[model samples]
Target: MTSVPMIDEILAEFLQSGLGIHVGTRNEQLLPAGCRATAIKVEDDGRHVVVFVPKSAAPAVFENLRTNGRIAVSMARPADDRAAQVKGLMMFSWDANPDEEALARAQWAGFLAQLDGIGLPGIATSSWRVFPCRAVRVKVTAVFNQTPGPDAGAALP
Candidate 1:
């Protein structure tokens, strides 16, 4: 695996804010599955990220990652629509720890608050608690800017 540089403070802040987190994976048959991540944890070094997914709501996505490692994750800031997309190989996927679960719940709450602040109809907080969740670690291979404008879709340096 290629060693990518640790994410900078700007991107780290964007991710830690829990604005938007979506994860996608594909099955052996090439069928795609995606689910919103309830929580995102960027390791201090920024070389890795773990996304928590509710087992009940994203069984297919979990299964896909378990069966096939290819994965893509996208995140966007609700305040300004600045966004990024990452494609990577799954490094690990397992039941989330208690701390991870708690963090995810808290982050989900923050995400909802951001939505509400923006005058958007927020999803019920209860919706995030399907329980028996899994946390998947991704080793990023490529990243692209997904924000609108000329720089959109360009590969990140």
Candidate 2:
């Protein structure tokens, strides 16, 4: 099994620190969507992650996430290429709070709209709360080495 850190504690740290995750789809048939976003919001109790994406791409992105239930997310410094990307199966959970959900929808719309002007293909930037499923499974790889890195080689320590 491939693993590189998907524990709740690690995810919580990422969320609290406001990390940037490169959200991509697992849809192999099409080119992956490469959009940047911060872990803007996390559930108060730690059940979900609120990510801000281009409003325009929200529908397709959410739809893809909903249908596929798989995502590759990573956090890296603004200028650093060395980062960790973990594949976590995601699901959309409805927020009982109408205002919050509405805000999410609005953000999604705005993010999606931005993509229209840009000629390049990319995912939309709507903000949605990501309720990741249980039973986390991750795929990990280390560059420049046949052996895994210090962090990549072991289970949650």
TM-scores, all candidates, are 0.87, 0.44
The number of the candidate with the highest TM-score is 1
Local distance difference test, candidate 1: 0.79
Off by over 4 Å in 1: 1-6, 128-132
Give the C-alpha miss distance for residue 96 in model 2, angstroms: 11
Model 2 lDDT tens row, 111-151: 34434444423553333443221112223221111123566
The lowest-lDDT stretch of 10 consecutive residues in candidate 2 is: 137-146
